[model samples]
Target: MKFGPIPTLQAKGSILAHSIVCSGRRLRKGVMLEDAHIEQLSASGITEVTVAQLQENDVHEDQAAAELAKALVPDVRAAGLECTAAFTGRVNLVATGPGIVDLQADRLIALNSIDPMISFATVPNYQQMRKGGLVGTVKIISYAVDAEKLRSACALGSAAIKILPPQLKTASLVVSQNANRNDEKGISAIKTRLDALGITLEKVIATEHEIDPMAKALSSLKSELLLILTSSATSDSNDTAPAAVRAAGGQVERFGIPVDPGNLLFLGRIQSRPVIGFPGCVRSPALNGADWVLSQIACGVSLNENSFAQMAIGGLLKEIPTRPQPRRPKK
Candidate 1:
């Protein structure tokens, strides 16, 4: 695109590169200078104005942004995302419902590498997303961009962003507590977490903080997802929660994720039902490793061995104020 100062008489049909006040009216930038606009500016004693004129081979910013958005989300319904109408040089993608943000990172990187004038930004890969949440955005920096580069970006980023909506609609939580302990915080916290993913907590059964009782409770669960929150923190793969899953005829896949504040979580499955051992950090609303696992499972997005390896990469979460100890010892 050609952008520079030009005589008011020669500015007609070009995009205004900057906002200016003319004839006591505020003319916004990106507006196409017309004959009346030029005449008004000339009458107001303005001799020059900067504007951007599109070249034959250039694509208009709004058009380019709209096209890129379409390419990124081919089927809005299936992708579980909706594209807002392109405005100026921006188009936003939002979730149609609660789910997980499944972004294609490699494709996004390639798209951004094509040129500096176009950018696609998103919430990270596998992010927990809620209904009407902002998933991603496409922005064209300049008033116009090279058509060839825009096409390349569109092709490389095709179908690159989507939301995996929740698959499991209901869950049953089994809490283990002593006879005198009637703490409802764990149950409330678990319900809040499940509600965020649009899942219903069908039952909250409290049992003795014992392997046999908890195992029996877990084995009798009929919800799509099963959960166990022990009064004591799970310290190892062979701890109470994981051992209870095994005792319930379930297969324990993993124990003790690497995320701080959530390092004690365990994952397993009973035939078809998935079980999650909530860590002590779940009493707070802050993001933790358990939220990641729950969101992935709720969306039916399975990973090999229900992997905790990926969690370690960005698992150092903000410490909850309720934590009794710090990550490091005092000097």
Candidate 2:
């Protein structure tokens, strides 16, 4: 059965509000958007527009693009911005006068030289890249954009996508208890905690599960972080414990936080993706493992092995002042 052509798909998920630009006019600073305005934009063809109070309390670039996209509706061009969609909150729109066949090599060269982590994803210009021809709709992520890079990228046979270091979304939560029922309960508790923090957890998987199958699932879903929470009592020696992580790829880290009730926590990641292990203490109302780890990851801090180790400097030790010993007995 043939389904009708669907419109272009952009990245969908929670994104940070970096900067907001609108019609090159910053929406009046304190002016709250009216629902009527939102409805009007939506009906006019602006799809999936959502507004919320932001940490910055002021719009920046990303927010500006999003708002412009929302206002322009059916006619993105009418919005006064140069691009149809902006990904990664960092983008440079090169106006090719509406029929430009390709972005130039200089564009990619410029963006690449500035940051090695810059990457591209095949977008509307797939055929162009294949034929060494130019196309449109290249998405790029870079620390900064160069005018030359913008020109060169568009000059390519087709528009190309430049993405940053791929972000891992799959988090592995390892429950140590042998009882399936207990493991399920622990997983439920952890999920609840994560949800409160606005982190969407994918699944609670068993450790013994095969890597190939597990990886296949994660790949299909495009998950980047892995979180492991343990309830099993393994020897501190690390000999009896199952592999800390099953994935042959990704990052890993262990946490022994200074926070009360959660000092026993451990977190590991396979690559840049997170693999966190939360001890039973997370269930307690007291601040626990999930609290600290969740905050760091939310702020875009990659919890690698070294960062985890650094966490130990002030984390595990307790402050106990020495009390003066009782006076010695008289001879």
Candidate 3:
């Protein structure tokens, strides 16, 4: 692209490089200087203005950004997302329905690295968003980019972000028999959190705190998802909850995550069904590691050891001030 001063009379069909105020009206940058605009600038006594003229191989900014954004998003709409028309070298990914934004951070990083002129940004991975939320955006840095660079960036960014509809629709809660009064509060809190995600707590199984009974309960339970709310947090893969999962012929994917307030969370699967061993922090509805794990499960995102490990980058859930405050002593 060639950018330099061009006489207003000769600037027709070129993109304005900067906004100019003329006769009480503003001519914004990126506006293609039409004959009318050229006449208006001449009438306003503007002799010359800086503009960008595209070379034969250069792609227009808006078209390039729109194509890259299209390549980045998956072909499947997934239920809650809409892609806006590219404008000003930007295409915004908006949420059409309320749900979690599931972004592939690693792929996004790769996409951005492919070209300096192309970039993308999104709400944090696994963020709960309302309808019409800005989930992701694609931006091209210059008035125009080389066609080859745009194509390379698009190849790198294909299917890098997804808006997943909440999928943890039905669940069963298994609590220990020695569950205290706090258990009621915890159950209520879990219900409220799940309800927000459109998950229903269809059945409750209260059993002895022993591993054998827990295992039996898990083996016998029939639900799309199983949640174990233990009186105590599991300390290891061999802990009671995880042990029960193993005894019930389930595979324990991971024992703990790097996220605080959710460090004790356990993830396991039994015959294709997900089982989450909740940490004590789950008793309260504050955002925590458990919420993160649950949100991923609900969104149908695959979970494994590496998935929990990758969360360390943004795992500081307790640092948010709006997080539920610890109970204070009665005056």
Candidate 4:
């Protein structure tokens, strides 16, 4: 019966009444019509309804009280309330307090809904309201995940289910083609040497191929870490180690290391997952990049570029030989 920005305050020959909900589509100055009134309008063949929450000071009823009141409705209101009307232009009301109240109309409308509300309307699907959904991947430089450490981080995310995507699997080896002829051993030799060190095939399985399926498997299984065993090639030689992983048709680069015995070792990722390659020295029980990488894994760190760069300091410490010389008996 009425149509305008200010809403027709006075209607003619109509049992129902109406008021302004907001000022020209802005979410200010609205009415708090009762749900019963909305239902009345619905039954009267009025299908559309829009709701808004107005500030208490909006009403000029008591000019003196407007200063102290944050919002204005004919009456004082609280937060978390909604004012409704059968139409859009005019609104007046202030519904407040907790608990969700039913709001119905002819067609479903998106008045003030946030993100997840209209996903189908956008090109890129909207992010889920819940955490962990569509979260970007994190790369770890370490070779394996420490279950205890990973479990702790999972708890913080409050994720009932954690998933490690398949992009994280990597290869492990005791020797590298990156090293000199004397130092470089094939994958078989590295495995054999590790076998001699009391490390069993079951403890760290070997793959005929360069990379292992376990990395992919663990990631798909939401695994938090991947452990890779590798041998160092040479120290300070400017040589690099082989790629930790390569897609079925991916590229491989750098084969030797520039460090000491730890030089031949390498650490890299397959699918953006963390990877740690142990040098031959890991077999010696001496401190090395492998140890530091393992510690980081145990701490559940993602081998992101920044985290990888931070390992330089620890790697330098590994190069130190603090072997204590036997002290002669004091006179």
Candidate 5:
């Protein structure tokens, strides 16, 4: 792209590089200079203006960005994602359904490293998104770019963004309680969380807070996922919840996460079904480590020690100021 000042009379057919005010009328940037525009500028005493003229091998800014964005999210469309039309060399990707947003962070970084003119940004990986949520966007800095560079950037974004639909739609809650089974508040909180994610709470099993009894309850329940809410947080692999999972013929995948407010969370698998030992943080509606784990599980992503460990980067959920204030004055 060649950009420089050109005389108004000779600026016809060139793209305006900058917005200008002439004769009380605005000629916006990216506007193609025509005979009438040149006449208007000449009449307004503006002899010269800056504009960008594309070379034979260079692509237009909008075309380059649109093509790259299209290449980046081709599969996203079929997965219930919508791509907006390129505007000012930008294209935004929006979600069409509620689901988990998965992003290829490494590939995105590499793509951005290719050239400063081409850039892409997206929401954090594994974010729970509602319909119409902005997931990703492509921005082209210059008015135009080399087609070869555009191609190189697009190649790095293959399968870069994905909206994984919720798969684990049903779950059973097994509460380990030594006292009465009438914990309406606890059950209601769990139910509300599951319902918001479109997951059904199929059964609620209340049993003694012991390995044997909890294991028996787990083995008897049938659901896509099992949630074990122990009366106390499990502190070891041999703790009641983890041991119960083992006794129920399940493997404890991970004991704890690095996330605060959810460091007590435990993960296991029983006969290909996922099991989670809920942390005390889950009793509230605020987002925490358990929400992150549950979102990944609902998206059919396998959970293990590495998965739990990887969450430390953005796991400071307790620091978020979304919690309810007990001492606040009522409106």
Candidate 6:
């Protein structure tokens, strides 16, 4: 595409490169200059105007943006995504329901590298999403880009993005509480998190913070998911929560994650149902590693050993006011 200043008489039929006011008329940028516009500019003594002339092989910005968006999410419904109409060379992808972002990093990276004018960005992989949340956006930076470049970007990815919706719908929380600590606050917080992922809290079982009592509670659960929140932090795999999961005919899969606030979290399974041992930080309604694990599991997203190991990066969350023991300790 050609972009530069030209005589007002020669600007007709070209896209206006900049906004201008002449003869009491506001001609916005990207507007196609017509005979009337040129006549007004001429009458206002504006001899020169900037414009963009498209070549036959160039794709308009709006068309390119929409096409790229379609390639990224061919079936919006199936992909759990919805797209806005392309406007001003931009198209936004939104989540159709509560879920987590699923994307092909390599494909998107290659798509972005195709040309500076073509851009695609989205939330991090496995990031939690809400209904109607903005997932990503496609943008064409110039008035038009070469068709070849746009085609390359479109070819790099097809249906490569989606929202992973929840598969687990019911959960039971078994909390171990002491007389000095109130369980109400933790129960409320856990309920809110589960509700967001479409999981119903079937019941809250109050039990002693002991292996035998917690184990009894765990074995009686019938929900698809089980959660344990203890008033005291579980310090080892043989601690109350992990041992109880084992005592209930379950196997503890992982005991520690690299995430700071959620390092004490653990995962186990009884029969076919998944069980999670919550860290104390989960009692507060804040972003934590447990939220990530819960959301992923609820959405049916598999987590390998590497997934827990990788949580170290970007897991240094800000310390909340309610933290019993701060990392640095008081000077």
Q: Highest lDDT among the candidates is held by which one?
A: 6
Provide the lDDT at 37 for model 3.
Answer: 95
Stretches > 4 Å off in candidate 5: 177-189, 318-331
Enumerate clash totals for all models, in the order shown: 0, 73, 0, 50, 0, 0
lDDT of 5 by residue, 73-158 (tens): 77766666888899899999898887788788898999999889898988998888888899888899888888888888889987
lDDT tens string, model 1, 1-331?
9999999899988999999997998889999988889888898899999999999999999999999999999999999999999999999999989999988898899899988899999997889988889989999999999999999999998998899989999999998997766659878888999999999999988888888888999888899999888888888888878888999999888777788878888889998999998888888888988899899999998866435677778889888877767787569
Q: Residues 1-331, candidate 3, lDDT per residue (tens digit)? A: 9999988899999999999999889999999999989988999999999999999999999999889877877673654567888999999988876568876677788878877778898889878876788988889888999898888788777877777887667998888767453488778888887887778899888888889999988998888899999886688899888999999999888888899768888889999999999988887667888888887788788976677778898887654333344434337
Instruction: Name the lDDT value of residue 20 in candidate 5.
Output: 92
lDDT against the true structure, per candidate, is: 0.89, 0.40, 0.84, 0.32, 0.85, 0.91
| Local accuracy of candidate 4 as per-residue lDDT tens digits, 28-115 | 2233345554444445544544332223322221221221111212232322222333122222222232111112111112211211
lDDT rank, highest first? Answer: 6, 1, 5, 3, 2, 4
**lDDT of each residue in 1-331, candidate 6, tens digit only:** 9999999999988999999999888889998888989899999999999899999999988999999999989999899999899998999999999999989999999899988989998988989999989999999999999999998899997888999999999999999988898889989999999989989999899998888999999988899999999989989999878999999999999988888788899999999899999999998898888999999999997777988877788888877778889898888
Task: RMSD for all candidates, in order, please.
Answer: 1.4, 19.7, 4.0, 22.4, 4.0, 1.1
Return model 1's CA RMSD, one decimal: 1.4
lDDT of 5 at 205: 89
**In model 1, how large is the Cα lDDT of residue 302?**
83
Report residue 292 deviation for candidate 4 (angstroms).
Answer: 1.3
* TM-score (all chains, Cα) for each model: 0.97, 0.36, 0.81, 0.27, 0.87, 0.97
Candidate 3 has which clashing residue pairs, if any?
none
Ranking by TM-score: 6, 1, 5, 3, 2, 4
Model 4: CA > 4 A from native: 1-203, 207-224, 230-244, 248-264, 305-309, 318-331
